[model samples]
Target: MEKYDYEQLVICQDKESGLKAIIAIHDTTLGPALGGTRMWTYASEGAAIEDALRLAKGMTYKNAAAGLNLGGGKTVIIGDPKKDKNEAMFRAFGRYIQGLNGRYITAEDVGTTVEDMDIIHEETNYVAGISPAFGSSGNPSPVTAYGVYKGIKASAKEVFGTDILAGKKVAIQGVGSVAYTLCEYLHDEGAQLIVTDINEEAVQRAVDAFGARAVGLDEIYSVDCDIYAPCALGATLNDQTIPKLNAKIVAGAANNQLELDKHGDLLHQKGILYAPDFVINAGGVINIADELNGYNRERAMKHVDKIYDNLETVFAISKRDNIPTYIAAERMAEERIASLRNSRSTFLQNEHHVISRR
Candidate 1:
């Protein structure tokens, strides 16, 4: 907890359901912690806890950067989603969330689904991304993709002095659901696309739909392009790959694109305008957060569109502070949280004074 300044960490278990999970709350200065629950077959208990803590901290920054009145938390179930899932397990998990008394809110994430969230909802009203019938926001991928698209445009404007994507070459590192939708938007803008994926079918789909050129997985990093979008996995911007990048900008849907803080610094040194992953990929969280206020699609979309403006702000801070964009993003979030923390402290002191007078 001291390493990351975590707020809380809970270990939950249910023998009957074979449920073993870790919930980590990293911050709540802005508001209650909101993040998704991920189920994975972690190698060890410690690994699961570490993942939960790291992800929770990332959510704190992601939420604050997106301008959401929420903090960061995350849950990790130590099991295989494919073979270990059961209704009883999810209900048990939900009960654990209920025990938090609204300090942490969970939704669907990798190895989990809306159905799992719905099951969790049975035990706690604190869950988001449940079925739309329950007034929840459905699949956040499209909204996330839209935000990345807008972020890319903002980065383009910063680098090329215009946001027009027509005739620009883009290398997309994934053709998954979010990246596929992002391709549609970029294709419509006449951006030339070079794509790659581990799944040939997915790659073929992008090729057929967007007329994208398919390349080998390793070939993606060296592709000649104006922008490189790493939409697949995290840490693609490490020491090995950074030197191979031929793009002028890095913007995508992946979380934790930089393997380490120094890699972000390396990108900055190379003059690559990187749209910080947390800031650009905040649309999904922004989409689900709207559920707190009765789930308005238009309102959520308008909020997602602000990703462009958010990136603009990050860039401005980068220039003003002469720091990497990643550092600037962190500064922005920290400043917001610090301001709110001060105001809340004053409000509480004033309330205490009134009570003391009475």
Candidate 2:
């Protein structure tokens, strides 16, 4: 293992905003780190740290798997985006990025919106997910959903031997941006949809838009469907929930779906085809990563549309290696990132001496 793999991750916290930000520049070989700026009210600094580190690492694998020329890094603002965000707080975050120079780039994710990125942009040049006016491809959730749609097709092929998507029952666990878009795709495919979300408005939107059956958050584990897609949060399926899943496949835009490492094996044992969360949901990152140069909305979309190919490769690798699909996908992505880092070691600082570079 590379020393980078074991290196202590760097993080900067702003006390005034109670922002416990982390920059897990998983690999800087390709370029400065680029990921999202997700704002959430974590219970504690320790919880925030855990989330930032895990999410940053997932970004690394996501970009690598998508073959993007960027690294993985993420920031977590410890406040409610709906009510707690202010200009001063974002500006403070910008200062943190400025201090890091160009090593870690930030964008919008989960709790944070594109408008938030615009605020962060005021403080530093190291920001993506800026508004369209700022010459950025904003709100990558739709593209992320596109990738998940394609991935669902690939998973369908592996499990059902077809990607036609029609008549497939897909239970979406969240009606957020990406999941909503995924529902749109599934709706077009004539898939029977079951959707759930903590947000009532989002659930109603699903009801109005696609006639998706609204399931309660507590009942998600019991939904009888061909595919149980957990798009809301991570670790939706664990020891208890996994046993209750009637879905033959589990794939969605949620990050770090496995609560623990052992959960991967649990899914494998249950014969449920699992597409790694980061791999399937990488469409958004792939799109934003495209904006570093000339913004080509069409070209960026084409890259995202290629999620089918990635899904196929992951599925094939899983079968060929007789390993869990999630592990197979992660290994594939890790190997690709390792290769890129090795190729660029001569140009980057501290890269040659420390393989544990993350």
Candidate 3:
């Protein structure tokens, strides 16, 4: 076993139902872990484990950078969401969450919907991103898209010396959920759009709504544009696709965009400014974090809009220091987390180990 490189990971299997699941809680840099639950028909348990662990880690940084009190975590149910789901499966999963106490919290993500979240909520209080009717702020995809929009502006400022996105060619690789909302922002900014998605209806919607040109889902690589926005699934920027990109800046809301970790260096070498995905896509989590009662929409949007400030700073840092934007952003996030942790140790030395996760 590779023993997940993650800070904490627990794989579960319900004895009676033979249901398999993996819960990965990356880091509680800011507070107790929180993120979404994903159900997929992964080919292997190991693959499911890897995805959960990696996504959970992304959540940690995502929440920390967004200035949210919650930490990052993720759950993966390995089976078909349509056919393999049932009350027992979710309850069995809920029991797993109960075992973790409050170390990790789970909500809706990908294959998991609000109705599914309702099921898990019955077992524990460690949940977020629930429907507003259930006393939550509701789905976070729109806010996620909003954050990406702000990030796009920041990327433009770094690459073009202006936040105005008007007339800039933007290639969006997906049209689902966040992508549609993101396109609205891009269209309002007067950006030229070249969009694609595996779903035909979504592609048509983009073309009809924004006068955006539709490209084949797999052909996003060949599109000539000023920016490449991947709002779809992960691992899209691999060795094969990176070589085909015509865009100068790659900014998107999808998690784990780089197919391989080394792809960051590849983008840098290619002179393509890569906005860190976790940083750019922190909007959803930021919005969901508001369910803590006394939550304010205005305050959440303010934080979502703050992506521009953080990214603008990262752009400044990268340009001044001549470093890759991704590297610069990650370094900045790590420094902020370390500084917070250090302050706690200095003031509350005895509580150091309690707050710090080695």
| lDDT values, one for every candidate | 0.96, 0.83, 0.85
The top-ranked prediction according to TM-score is 1
TM-score to native of every candidate shown: 0.97, 0.91, 0.92
Compose the digit string of candidate 2's lDDT tens values, residues 281-312: 88888888888886799999889887889888
lDDT score for residue 227 of model 2: 89
Cα lDDT for residue 102, model 3? 86
Ranking by lDDT: 1, 3, 2
Record all residue pairs in model 2 with backbone atoms less than 3 Å apart, i.e. clashing: 2-355, 2-356, 3-355, 3-356, 4-355, 4-356, 4-357, 5-356, 37-107
Model 2 scores a C-alpha lDDT of 0.83
Clash numbers, per candidate:
0, 9, 0
Candidate 1 deviation (Cα RMSD): 1.3
- Backbone clashes in model 1, listed as residue pairs: none
